[model samples]
Target: MREFMVELTTAVPEGTDPAEVDRRRAAEAVRAGELAEQGRLFRLWRPVGEVRSVGIWRADDESDLRSNVLGSLPLWPWMTAAVTPLQPHPNDPGPTG
Candidate 1:
């Protein structure tokens, strides 16, 4: 598996119904939990005062990350994401250190 750092930002379309946005948010939370349980989603965070999020994700490859993971996001249509693959450093101390 490969790890990726994903940065995402969401925008609620102007003039959209607030209730509908709320509903989407609820669904997003549910999907997030499911992904976490499946071990695809490693960690998530929100940038303070910004409509942005960061996630550490594990996937078999970039295609899986794009299709099964990002594509499956409920709010994907309204979001923009940047993905960066991570590689381990040889000299860094690991858990055993």
Candidate 2:
């Protein structure tokens, strides 16, 4: 498997309905949890006061991560994502103890 750091910048159009934005955000959170349970998403964080987010992801390859993971994001249409592949570190904790 490969690990990647994905940075996301959200862009909710100014005229979009607030209720729809809220709905999409809530749905996005639910989908994120599902990805976590599937082992595709490892960690997620939001930058302080920024319209951006970061997530650590695992997949067989970049294509898999893009198609199966990123592609399935609920808020994908309103977000721009940059992905960087990560290398395993010797001192890093393994998947399990």
Candidate 3:
């Protein structure tokens, strides 16, 4: 698997129903959990006071990440994601014991 750093920003369109937004948000959370359990989602963080998140994700490739993983999100239509492929550094300490 390949790793990627993904930053996502969400913007609900104007005039959208509040109930619909709530429903999608809930579904998004569920989907996120599934991805996490599958080991595709590694870590996530939200910047203070921002409607955005940064996360580390794993996938077979960029195409798989975009299509199967990211495109599956319920809020994907309203989300803008920036994906950066990650490479291991020789000086990296690796995982903690």
The model with the greatest TM-score is: 3
What TM-score quantifies how close candidate 1 is to the native fold? 0.89
lDDT of 2 by residue, 1-97 (tens): 8999999898998899999999999999899999999999999998898879998999999999888899898888888989999998999888773
- What lDDT, from 0 to 1, does candidate 3 have? 0.97
Considering lDDT, where higher is better, how would the candidates rank from best to worst? 3, 1, 2
Q: Please tell me which model should have the higher TM-score, number 1 or number 3.
A: 3
**What tens-digit string does per-residue lDDT give for candidate 1 at 1-97?**
8999999899889998999999989999999999999999989999888779999998999899989898898898998889999999898696663
Error of 3 at 88 (Å): 0.7
Poorest 10 consecutive residues by lDDT, candidate 3: 88-97
TM-score of each: 0.89, 0.87, 0.94
Which pairs of residues have clashing backbones in candidate 1?
none
Report how far off residue 63 is in candidate 1 (Å): 1.8
Q: Write the per-residue lDDT of candidate 3 for residues 1-97, one digit (tens) a residue.
A: 9999999999999999999999999999999999999999999999999889999999999999999999999999999999999999999998877
Task: Flag regions of model 3 displaced more than 4 Å.
Answer: none
lDDT of each: 0.91, 0.91, 0.97
Off by over 4 Å in 1: 95-97
Q: Positional deviation of 4 in candidate 1, in angstroms? A: 0.3
